[model samples]
Target: MSGTWQCSPAELEVHLGFRESNPQSKHAEFLGPPFLTVCCLLPSFSRLDMDRFLMRNVTKGTTTVKRKKSLDNDDDVETAEDTETMQRSQKISKKNNFDDENEPQTERIETLCQTFSEILTTDLVWKKVIKSNLDLSHTILFSKGIANTVMELLEEEVVYFTGDLAKVQVFGRWHNIPRKQATYGDPGLTYKYSGKETPGRAWPPVVKAVRDLVNRVTGYHYNFVLINRYKDGQDKMGEHKDDERELHPDTPIASLSLGQTRDFYFRHQDTRPPKKLNIDKVQMPLHHGTLLLMNPPTNRYWYHALPPRATAKGVRVNLTFRKVVPAAASSSSNNKQ
Candidate 1:
């Protein structure tokens, strides 16, 4: 009416009805629709000012009306701002998933080390040793909970050999090895068996922690560990000795077992058939968290094997920690070169 009015488009349309055209009107060209009839009614406002006011009011009115209609109709109408927010949320979710999938391996190892260090115990319970030159010093190095955590950590961190390295050559042909195997130890150290030579990898944090624990308990420094994972009763190790040339002479080999209880057989090397040796083969159940130290003379006379058993349904992981002579390894490498 006077200076300015803040009426909506619908209210303005209702107040100013369509009027007959005045041919001689000064702003007749701008007077056509019911909404634009304000041009004729409000002559005090200039053309540009009127256009801006109408545009702003009309846009606001249209948005309000659409929102009201959508609410009445139960429609899920998304505004421009709402759509942009949703798009940003989706992008953030995808980035989080990518970050989780590509987590740093070193961070994972550190976490495993912390976890084992907290749960593992230093208290030892020595079991009686039935065989000569064998030390079952710590029947239980880890409690049930610690053993379970160790198995889980091993499952998450251990990486076994693949392709040709995964197979073992027996007799003349190569066959898939019954159990998964991995080696970790000092640099430049290698273990050879069945026509395959496996170089030692850097020790993972979980493995290094366990190695330190074994070393403290046994009072011996070991530089190499051969890990064997038996999936079930079907996976096994053949009767053989850890008599590799790289092993330190007279040093004991520490065998740590985790997971399922399995039979570990030790047969005298001379008691094949023709020999009149009266020595009986030793059958020991390598239970979870048991540490069996095969001292010097044991490996010399006994051939140990983890024969497959139909009753063993659970997985078993064995870590045989050995002291490898660095000089011997270097000499062997020089000869090969």
Candidate 2:
């Protein structure tokens, strides 16, 4: 059985389970399970059919496992790619949000600064006049268009104080203030006068723009602006010195005027009442869009006022910008207590 064996077609049909069509032919066809046993025992017997069947099943199983492993590796690569893409997108979104918030504001500020520089260089009319301790510098700061825009903005957005804050206590007598007033500045800044205190409000855009322009032109930093709106010439301010304890020592006060023209008078401290010293009073007309910087020692030695004039019938808005020392303001409040 180990070597080749010759057999009749009839014997082959019984052992191999197939009937050969040609009985006289030498080739025989193996058909069923009987061939499996015969091929396992006899090495020379026809075993090609069994070998081919087992090889096909083994190849199919190996191919299936390889395909599954490849598919799993592809899934892992895709998941990592998706995670990396999501992280990159989040970072880009945050950067875009930051740019959206700040870029426009920064560009606007820079543009304003450039416009101010141009206007100051070409159109400014500077005049410096010094009288005794009064160091004054006058200039036409704003153009007609800019001045009108500012007035419109103020009318629309600015809110004046009401109730107790709308009145001032003078000489133990409480009276309604003649003019509408407001204060805008940094936090904790307060302006106290005539036995009343005016707390600072947050700076409005128009006010901040004007302040930045003033600072650029005068090379001085001002943190607070006292805004006074006179309805007519009859609404006036009495003689007073702006020598408050909360003010920064030696800093100049920038006064910007809009609308009607009004006469500003400065009298020496010694020239009033009992002293009656022989000193000439200074008078200047503050016109629309004008800027007046009162330098150091002016408030210390002079009393300034805007008297009533029936001829000046139009409304006037005055912004007096000053620097406030927060520590000094706190100390002043403590002293009162």
Candidate 3:
């Protein structure tokens, strides 16, 4: 239960004890009689939902006013007016207005939920839960305006590392890698990519926003995001299993795609009987503004990649958000690569 909440007086309160609390003021103003009639009346909504709602409604006060022994003015109290201001501001802002990215992303998404909260849980446009070797879900995340916004952010804010592909020791000898890539994550999140140590860079704001959205839809806390920029049909990826030593095996990997749609290929790592022939090799078209979540053993047995489409002319951006353990930490725990 929300601690010590006061109800504001209104006809609705009498009908339902839930009060019309002010958003701007410090506390809800209670004036009318106690609410008797109700359709499941409560001081506030769900604690989890309210936690996010409050962040969306409240803003940093301009001045640090100490708890005065006496009231400075009734205006010092928070009220519906403040909440109205927050609502209007939130509706107008579709971009990353919140500068602090380190705070919990669920709180950020919860803020967005306040705008039209009833539909927050229904955000995944076409979510399909798979009960197979992998804990996977293929869901479309954005459409129309929101999709456009994501594209713009990807184009303007996210910077790709454009340089000669580093010659990594593949089968022993060094070989240049294809596709431009960038990695963002917490400090010291290093992984072996093509026999090269790839240390993660600090997380970006927009990237963090995308990660938050994925977490909201998939319920996974992804700490590292590896972005692959396919400039055109020429840039491609090789089929490889993500069974690496650093990755947390059970932690599912979430991939968010933007820009061009591409055919992503997948196949089994080991030979299976005819009953599993359908999954021996499969091609799934990953469309723009969609989320593909690959869960456990999938990484352990399935190898996936985006082959050179040749026909695809448009650029495609894909972010594989994952959780990686620190090298020292991974050394101790026998986690599946």
Candidate 4:
């Protein structure tokens, strides 16, 4: 009576209650002066009755929403109450919609990753199986394909080693030089050989890529590569181990070979006790475009060399990757050569 009836009583009377009541009973008697209620308390139903009907229908229908918007005065812009009501409605919607899928619905996040064998060092189709012969030296071969790529980059433009007189000279003449050697590494690292301080060269692209690949496979990083270019079989390395003071004591040395194949030998450092002599020498033919990873303790316990291969032909490039201890980093700061 206070305000005009908003809901269509004639339309909803049968749906609300009239159809179920006795036909003899008047319409007013069936519904008892129907006063509709929306969200909050109104005049018709008792407190508990209104709350029960509201609590039940609020979770099931659009009635709660239409009523909440009426309080907002039909404005298009939402008030805080409207926002809170919408949020609650959303939570109810989510809860009601949370049905168990016939098979548990799984969201698959597809991603792809490349392995060392898949991208770089090994046979493209086969798994990269690292072979370890622990007697004299622990060495693993990367691939010929990658090795060729590395060589192409290095051979393009090279800066040979110079200024180290002793490295190239034995006695009075400059005759002892077996092969040309160039040191490439972090800036400021100086290694003294041939009676002169040889500072390292800045890393080149091919060399840096090899370093990255080595780190990915072996889990070790190197800051330097002692590049030895053997022009032919005549160019050979002596029977000696890389036990330099500047190198990291525990890290392995990575020797990558390119071009021609050659024989590389490892012998027990004569200093080891007689009991270990049974494992005296290990000789292996190092093929072209292969990487020989000489892990730790090999330098600690064995002596290795590229003994002159008399019948060998073509140029063989060797890149021996090594690490200089962090402690020596400061020492080389003063001189780059």
In order, the Cα lDDT scores of the candidates are 0.59, 0.61, 0.52, 0.49
Across residues 1-337, which tens digit of lDDT does each residue of candidate 2 receive? Answer: 0001134444322222123222363322221121111111111111121221111112211211012233224342324423443354345334333223244544534444444444432234456768888888776665443455456567656799899988754335566767888889888887776556678899887788888888887888899988989899777776667888788877888999998878776778777655667877777777667788888888888777676666789989999999989998778777877
Model 3 segments more than 4 A misplaced:
1-119, 125-135, 162-165, 171-173, 272-279, 327-337
**In order, what is each prediction's RMSD in angstroms?**
36.8, 47.5, 21.3, 37.7
lDDT tens string, model 4, 166-249? Answer: 244323444435677777788767554333455578876556666666666556888877888888877766555566667787
Better by lDDT, candidate 4 or 3:
3
How well does each candidate superpose onto the true structure, as a TM-score?
0.64, 0.65, 0.59, 0.55
Model 4, residue 125: what's the lDDT? Answer: 17
Indicate the residue-level lDDT of 293 in model 1.
Answer: 83
Better of 2 and 4 by lDDT: 2
lDDT of 3 by residue, 74-98 (tens): 3344445445443533443433333
Cα lDDT, model 3, residue 216: 70
User: Model 2 lDDT vs. the true structure?
Assistant: 0.61
Better of 1 and 2 by lDDT: 2
Model 4 TM-score, 2 decimals: 0.55
Lowest-lDDT window of 10 residues in candidate 3? 34-43
RMSD of 3: 21.3
**What C-alpha lDDT does candidate 1 achieve relative to the native structure?**
0.59
Give per-residue lDDT, candidate 4, residue 77.
51
Of candidates 3 and 1, the better by lDDT: 1
